[model samples]
Target chain A: EDQVTQSPEALRLQEGESSSLNCSYTVSGLRGLFWYRQDPGKGPEFLFTLYSAGEEKEKERLKATLTKKESFLHITAPKPEDSATYLCAVLSNQGGKLIFGQGTELSVKP
Target chain B: EAGVAQSPRYKIIEKRQSVAFWCNPISGHATLYWYQQILGQGPKLLIQFQNNGVVDDSQLPKDRFSAERLKGVDSTLKIQPAKLEDSAVYLCASSLTQGRFYNEQFFGPGTRLTVL
Candidate 1:
């Protein structure tokens, strides 16, 4: 069975604090790993896509790194605007459907 | 470019009633998807369509749930005789293609359904 799990269900950080959210996945054949940020009352916004292990991608204050069994989304000196639920999803070669994690709720207090 | 669009941002209804939600994917997108997201949980795929052809609908409860993408540009999902457990956010997403490789999916604001 393919599944995705995210740790630290909720996190609170200061305006300039840095932290990392984890996403662990188990799938038959990994095709891609994705990260998305979702704000309250809005849909999720795409962040990054890692196609293979040892791959990394970054945008502004966010960086995402991938491994064979897990992925990490690192937030550097996050601001209040960065506060949102981060979701992780994995696409398997067996199908186009995405297996998603429960997501990590982040709060960056300014 | 405009993102995926869904109508009726919120709906409240009694159990056993029927309801429907609509979605218009980004222009030129060939792949569309519908998902059910319960509060505090991840979005679960209910149905997927590739250019008006059904790609997957394994998780959809056929007894009460049905969806259609008549023209391959827009889609609608209907739930008849809704149950309490069906109260959740129905999200619509779209991708450029239904290929083996990676295809980024764009999501809509979603229709929040509350069954009383």
Candidate 2:
């Protein structure tokens, strides 16, 4: 069965603190890996998509790297405004659907 | 361009009642998706539509859940005889196309449903 797991259900970081969130997956065949940011009372917004192992993408203070079995979202000098739930999803070659992880709830305090 | 749009940002109802949520995907998007997001969890795809055709509905609860995108632009998701477990945020997303590995989906503000 295809499954995605995100570690550290919640994290509290001080402003300007850098951290990494993990997203591990088991899929038949990896087509792509996606990262999204979701704020309270809103739907998730697209962040990045990694299509292969050793691939990486970045946007502002967020960087996402992918591997054969997992992906990592590294935050650099995160601000309070950057606080939001980060979600990871995998699209398998077997189907066109995306399998999502539980997500990591991040809180940045000033 | 305007993003995906959803209606009724919030709804509260009793168990066993019926409710419907609507979604309007971005202009020219060829694919639409409906997802259920429980608190503290990632969004789960309930159905996927490609130009008014059902590409996937395997995860949707057929007995109580039904969705339609008749015009290939606007879609509606209905839950009949809602269960307490049905309480969650209904999210709608759209992409330029489906079956492409690089397609990025854009989401809308979800409709929060609370069943008592």
Candidate 3:
């Protein structure tokens, strides 16, 4: 069965603290790995998509990288505004579906 | 383009009561999805539709949960005789292609359903 597992179920980071959230997966075939940001009482917003290993994309303070067995979302000098539940999902060709990880709840303290 | 749209931001009902949630995906999106998000967990896909046809519903509780995307544009999900376990945020999302590229999925403000 395809599954996604995110590390540090919950994390607390002080302002300007840098960290990386891990999303490891086991699936038949990897189509894409997605990253999203979700605030409390709101839906998720698209963050980044990594298609293959060694591929990386950046936006402001966030960066995403992917490999055959895992993906990582790295935050550089994050602030309180970056606090939210970061979700990682794996798109599988086996069933044309996305299996999500439980997510890493990030708390950026000021 | 306008993002996905959902209605009844909040709904509270007693167990066994029937409740429905609606969704309107992007203008030209061919794929629509419904997900159930239990508190403190990731969104779990309940059903998926590709142009009004059921593509994947393996996780849907068909016995009481039903969904349809008439005309392949807008959709609705209904839970009849709801159970306490059904209390969760029902989220709607959509993407341009049914399944091919790594298109990003757009989400809407979910409907919070509370079953008493």
lDDT of 2 at B16: 97
Residue A96, candidate 3: C-alpha displacement in angstroms:
0.6
Pairs in steric clash, model 3: none
lDDT of 1 by residue, A1-110 (tens): 89999988999999999999999999998999999999998888999999999999999999999999999999999999999999999998887789899999999998
Off by over 4 Å in 2: none
Candidate 3 chain A weakest lDDT stretch, 10 residues: A91-100
| 1 versus 3: better TM-score goes to | 1
TM-scores, all models, native as reference = 0.99, 0.98, 0.97
Q: What is the lDDT of residue A81 in candidate 3?
A: 98
Best by TM-score: 1
The per-residue C-alpha lDDT of model 3 at residue A5 equals: 95
> Lowest summed-lDDT stretch of 10 residues in model 2 chain B?
B96-105
Docking quality (DockQ) of candidate 3: 0.82
- DockQ numbers for every candidate? 0.92, 0.93, 0.82
Alpha carbon deviation, residue A21, candidate 2 (Å): 0.5
Which runs of model 1 end up more than 4 angstroms from their true locations?
A: none
